[model samples]
Target: MSRMIFVNLPVENLDRSKRFYEAIGARNEPKFTNEAAAMMVLSDTISLMLLTKPFYATFTSKRIADAHSSSQVLLCLSCESPAEVDQLVEAASANGGKADPGPKQDIGGMMYGRSFEDPDGHHWEPMWMDPQMAEAGAHPVESATAVSN
Candidate 1:
């Protein structure tokens, strides 16, 4: 079996976080979700667990970082196309999410990306890449001109 990843985040409002994840295309895994936590399935092998701050505290003794004030980690996902990346960013922003002020990334013609901050201030980046260029180990700028149909 392939390895699976479960990214856990502490949320101030479990319901709001679940809605945000669903708005961004994640499906709710009710079997693993409850009032204190929610399981948002991103892909076949990727899932995100949104836990209430108090419940999440049980995992570690360290203090929970205020995501709105400080960035703890950036969650990024690969999209099928540039349009899909934009779509996700748009949806997220329309649904209680904020656009990241960071510069947009367009690595030549090989990669395109944008990011958004969820209501709880968690960062999520959506990106699209040219598979061929990546497989060929092509330089960002050089490959833009080299890759041809």
Candidate 2:
């Protein structure tokens, strides 16, 4: 069987998180959802298990970190192109999310990335890479400038 990744996160409001994720293109898996948790399907192989804070605490004795105040993880998703990254960021902003306070990244003209924070302050990055630039092994700054144009 293929391995799958389930990124479990504690959410202050399960329903609001569900709406935010769905609005940004995640599909809701009703079969795995309940009042205390929601299964947000990012892809066939990746899922986000959004659990209410109380339910999340049951799985671990450690106190849950407030994502708004401190980050525990930076979740990243890849897109087919730079356009898709922009689209996701736009969708996120339109649905109660905001762009990353930091600047966007252009890696050696091979990769591009943008980030946003959800309502619960979970950080997410959507990125894209150019296969040709990687294959050529071009300098990052040089390629980055070329791609930026």
Candidate 3:
């Protein structure tokens, strides 16, 4: 079986978070959803489990970091094209998410990306890369630095 990734996040308002995710194209997987948590499926291999603060606490002994004030991880998703990347960011903004939480990235026309923050401040980046450039082993860091200079 193929391995799947399930990202668990703590949400302040489960219903609001679920709605935000749905607006951004994720569908709720009712099989694993309940009052304290909702399973949002982003793709066949990627899913998000949105849990209430109390429920999330039960899973971890550490204090939950306020995502609105601090960040723990940056989530990224690959897109088919630059337009798609922009579309996702725009959709996020229209649906209560904060857009452009980070600087926009364009690495020598080989890659393009934008970032946004969900209602709870979880950072998300949507990006697209030239397939040919990727196959050629083009280095993003090298191109990004070159573009900045």
Candidate 4:
């Protein structure tokens, strides 16, 4: 079986978050979707499970962090190119989201990333990596967010 990732997040209003995500080209999967939550199809291997506050709380006993006041996560999505990264970030803004002052820029490796905070202030990072540049660097990844020795 192929390993996949389902990034789940809590939203104040399930329907409102659904609309915001749908406007950005994410398809909604209604099979498992309900008033309490919506499944946003990002790709075959990746999906985002958007759950309402109550539904989300069911998964954990810890108090949910207030995204508008503090961040608990940064969702990162990769694009085919830097252009795609920028376009998606712009799309988020068009659909009522906030953008960071500047994006992660690694021109030498042809990699670039930008961040946007959703309506609820959940941070998301849109990014791209150029294969050719990566090859030139002799390493697949260099500017990773975290360093491991």
Candidate 5:
């Protein structure tokens, strides 16, 4: 069986966060949803567990970081093309997310990406890469290492 990833996020408002994810194409999995939490399926393998702040806190002893003021992580999704990346970012912006919260990226036509922040300030990046370049293993990291060596 293939492994699946469930990203657990703390949400200030469950309903609003659920709606925002739905607007961006995630579907709710009712089997795991309640007033305090929601299971938003982003793809066959990727799911998001949106937990209310108090509910989230119960999982750990450390104080929750205010995502709006401090970033704990940056999540990224792969896209089919640069246009698809742009489309997702636009949809996020129209649905209460802040578009381009981080700088846009274009790596010599090999990669293109943009970022957005959800209503609760979770950062998401949608990115695309040239298939041929990827298959050839010509990503930026390898190129930079080669140049430095």
Candidate 6:
């Protein structure tokens, strides 16, 4: 079996966050989701464990990062193309989220990534990449990437 990674996020409202993800075409896995948290399936092997704030608080002694006033971290996800990047950003806006108001980056034939923030101010990045940029004999990053060609 392939090694799967689950990124867990602290959300204020499990149901609300679930709806936001659903608005952007993500599906919830009932087998791993409930009122306390929702398993957002980003792909076949990648999932997000969206845990409620109190539930998430158990994971750390330090306070959870504030998602409204300031952000100390940014979560990045890959997109299929530059267009998909734009579309996802737009969708986020329509679903009560906002843009980061920055320029798109071109990494000279290697990669391109854009960032967005959720309703709670958690950052999400959409990146496009080229397979030729793979390191030596590595397979690839589990996160999907958008390619020009």
Q: Please name the candidate that would achieve the greatest lDDT relative to the true structure.
A: 3
Model 6 sits at a Cα RMSD from the real structure of: 5.6
Give the Å error, residue 125, model 1: 1.2
Q: Arrange candidates by TM-score, highest first: which order?
A: 3, 5, 1, 2, 4, 6
Q: For candidate 1, lDDT tens digit of each residue in 1-149?
A: 99999999999989998999999899999999999999999999999999999999999999999988998798888999999988998999999999754557877668888888889888888888899866877555564542211
Q: TM-scores across all candidates?
A: 0.90, 0.88, 0.93, 0.85, 0.92, 0.79
lDDT, model 4, position 88: 83
Model 5 lDDT per residue over 1-149, tens place = 98999999999999999999999999999999999999999999999999999999999999998989999999999999999999999999999999998888877677888999999999999999888878878545466321110
Clashes of each: 0, 4, 0, 0, 0, 1
Question: Residue 46 of model 2: what lDDT?
Answer: 97
For all candidates in order, the CA lDDT equals 0.87, 0.87, 0.92, 0.80, 0.91, 0.76
lDDT of 4 at 72: 73
What TM-score would you give candidate 3 relative to the actual structure?
Answer: 0.93
lDDT of 4 by residue, 32-139 (tens): 798888899988888889999899999999999998888677788888888888888888888878876345555554677778887888888887877776567835
Model 4, residue 107: distance off in Å is 3.1
Off by over 4 Å in 2: 133-149
lDDT string, candidate 2, 1-149, tens digits? 88999999999988899999999999999999999999999999999999999999999999899888998888889899999999999999999998864468876557898889999888898988887765666565463453332
> Cα lDDT for residue 146, model 6?
41
- lDDT rank order: 3, 5, 2, 1, 4, 6
Model 1 vs. true fold: TM? 0.90
- TM-score-best of 3 and 4: 3
Residue-by-residue lDDT tens digits, candidate 6, 83-121: 787788888878877775445665564667666677777
Q: Residue 126: error of model 2 in Å?
A: 0.6
Model 1 error, position 128 (Å) = 0.6
The RMSD (Cα, Å) of candidate 1 is: 4.1
TM-score of 4: 0.85
Clashing pairs in 5: none
